[model samples]
Target: MRQRRWFPPLALAVGLFAINVVARLIIRLGFDGNDAASGRASIIMFAVIGLTMAVWTFLACQRKRPSDWLLPDLVVGAIAALLLTVLVGPFISGGEPFKDGAGDFFAQIWLYAGFAIVGTLLGYWLAVLLGRDYRSRALKAFAERSKSKPRKVVRR
Candidate 1:
């Protein structure tokens, strides 16, 4: 049976949201009422998210073309995850989404976007440098195949 096109993006979104949920839960339960600690934890959570995205991108680039995965999978998933994190994540921490004001809300969005972009770039660049990305691997295979096959002679 063929897999659905939406499944991968949806799965990725859910995984990213789960990470947010866990981080929110930890902050709520363990760092509640501690402003400094909460700030530190939030930084750590964002860092984790960035690292997760980096690893995810690295592995994905190995198997699929960026054109194939970048839009349909990564962007969709990241957007979904961003929405969930912005709208639903606060509830996990026992708070409303906009309780901290619009500025803070926008700040969160910026942070998420910045980290995601940086992570993705880092992952893709690393894969390209290592010649492990799909394009690199495909080119290598093509070169090997051409080398193995001899050129045919043309009849006069």
Candidate 2:
């Protein structure tokens, strides 16, 4: 058996962190004094993250069975991305998450976690609804195999 590689999940984590860094840069440099614009950008960033996760989850489910490590990879990748964003991203924007206040820090965490969970659930449920989950695929394969087999002759 071949070992599963971690490159995909690691890349996803880096990509998510990069998105956060871009959002922080836009808020810090482009909309420094404009509260409304900053809020809008933040919301858009969160939406993008949620959508990304959802689409990724959907595609992964289509390609692999649930017993595979897709969900675990997604969870671990999200945690890594969240940690990178909260702990290191602010530094790039020349700000300290805690120095600003605890409220802001916690808010960011809640927003990231909420979006990730919602996205994952939505993706998985949508796949199940569409008959694309592991059980559906397995049942489909079994049905096909059963149909293709030669029927044994038996007369009552």
Candidate 3:
């Protein structure tokens, strides 16, 4: 086993945090005048984050070692997003952190988790369908090359 590098996952987590900030900003700017609209906007923002994660997962699967990025990358990214949502978002909104109903807070967590799972599945399946998934493509290429060569037996 090799020691995993931290920089990529750290960068990914930072990127996730930036996404949360941008989403919050967008919701704040575009829907602040109406509470209902703001809530909808927030939900859309969360969906976008999930979509981003899905795309990232697909790209990561194109590599020889998809596992390298799957678990840690997502774990760190989700944590970063969660922290930003819980700790920073309310402050930016000029409200106490966690002031909103518990349902809203829990909803955020559920929405984020759902998005991450859906994104990961979407990415993985897309890679498989495109014949670019790490293991699938590797196996295909190996079979092709083996079929092209003649096998020889030696007695020693």
Candidate 4:
């Protein structure tokens, strides 16, 4: 059996998680005071995170056709990154991750999931719209099948 490589997705997840940590640390150190500044920092963080996921998804889709492993691996990486951002990031920033409340906790989860899912969908859909996805491949196959003529066997 061929062994599956786990390094690419794992590295991407860890890198994304590190981005979260850096954002948290910056917010904690430089924008910790004014409520408006903190809010802006948080929004910026979320935007950056979302955009990063979108770009990553877009590139992944362009690199290969859709497969079971592609989306699932991306989702897993996003979840892992999200967990690191929420569970461990705040500690590094000298703050509590769930300091706001449980509601905020779940909201972060929802937000991360929403961004990841939307980005993934957008990437794949864009590929499909451009005739570069599995649907396109199947359509091409169907066209070829319809165009080809079957050969008749000659009997003695």
Query: Ranking under TM-score, best-scoring first?
Result: 1, 2, 3, 4
Better of 1 and 3 by lDDT: 1
Off by over 4 Å in 3: 1-4
Off by over 4 Å in 2: 1-4, 150-156
Maximum-TM-score candidate = 1
lDDT of each prediction vs. the true structure?
A: 0.90, 0.84, 0.76, 0.75
User: What is residue 5's positional error in candidate 1, in angstroms?
Assistant: 1.1
Clash pairs for candidate 2? none
lDDT, candidate 4, 1-156, per-residue tens: 223556657766897787777877888889777779877776777777777777776666655656744766686788789888889887887878789898988887887777767777777777777876666867888989878968678999
Cα lDDT tens digits for candidate 2, 1-156 = 124578667877998888888998989999998999988998888888888888878877887876674666788889999999889988988987787798999999999989887887788888889988777888999999999999999999
TM-score of 1: 0.95
lDDT of 3 by residue, 43-118 (tens): 7777877787878888878884766777777677677767777777777766656687888778777887787788
In order of appearance, the predictions have TM-scores of 0.95, 0.87, 0.86, 0.78
* Number of clashing pairs per prediction, in order: 0, 0, 0, 0
Sorting all predicted structures by lDDT, with the top scorer first, yields 1, 2, 3, 4
Over 4 Å off in model 1, which ranges? none
Clashes of 1: 0
